[model samples]
Target: MIDLALNFAFVAVGLAQVLALVRLVRGPHVGDRILALDTMVINAIGLIVLVGVKWGTQMYFESAMIFAMLGFVSTVALARFVLRGDIIE
Candidate 1:
């Protein structure tokens, strides 16, 4: 039962990721695309955490944290670019 639940969760996350990717590609505006990309990264982190739990390893969680940090930085940079035409200063 636990295994089945994990499998289902994985499938759901995978489908969500595919939808997010589609949105990122088909978004009408740069901001919308960036938001979609952020969502994708978040979902990826969740997937990694789930997998880590299933495998009894902590490395996936650490990587997930790194991915989240990078995603946040990228999102801030992109938003700054869109708002001010430059990411640095």
Candidate 2:
């Protein structure tokens, strides 16, 4: 049923987040850690969207969009810093 699917999705996303956290903590290189952090942000956005779908609300969608944008911007900034040692010129 739909409820069962939602529960499964929640569990799956939770597990993914946990794995990402572990990678973030144990990554041997800066790039690996950054990749893990980005993955965590993506997982969080998925959770937020799932919640919105379950509750039949639109507010969570807005927040999810904001989070996605912030995640992307931060990832780009971090990558820039790693490449050039400065986020902005």
Candidate 3:
């Protein structure tokens, strides 16, 4: 059923978010932590979309889009900082 599938997706994404958080905290390298943070952002977006589907609302979709854009920018900035020792030159 569609409802069952949605529930399963939610559970899977939730677990993924938790694991990503663990990796973010325990990762040995800065790059690994950054990757984990990116993964967490993706999982958060998945959760937002799932909530929008369940509630039949359009607002969550907009929120998800905004979050995605911000996540991307932040990730790029972090990567740049790690590589160049500064985000802005």
The model with the greater lDDT, 1 or 3, is 3
**In candidate 2, what are the lDDT values of residues 1-89, reduced to their tens digit?**
99899999999999999999999999989999999999999999999999998998998988999999999999999999999999889
Model 2: residues >4 Å from true position, as ranges?
A: none
> Which candidate leads in lDDT?
2
Q: After superposition, how far is residue 53 of candidate 2 from its true place, in Å?
A: 1.0
Error of 3 at 28 (Å): 0.5
Clashing pairs in 3: none
Q: State how far residue 52 of model 1 sits from its true place (Å).
A: 0.2
Full-model lDDT, candidate 1: 0.93
**Candidate 1: misplaced stretches above 4 Å?**
none
Candidate 3 structure quality by residue, lDDT tens digits, 4-87: 999999999999999999999999999999999999999999999999888888989789999999999999999999999998
| Maximum-TM-score candidate | 2
lDDT order of candidates, top first: 2, 3, 1
- Residues 18-85, model 1: lDDT tens digits: 99999999998998999999999999998998899799898787799999999999999999999999
lDDT of predicted model 3 = 0.95
What local lDDT does model 2 show for residue 46? 96
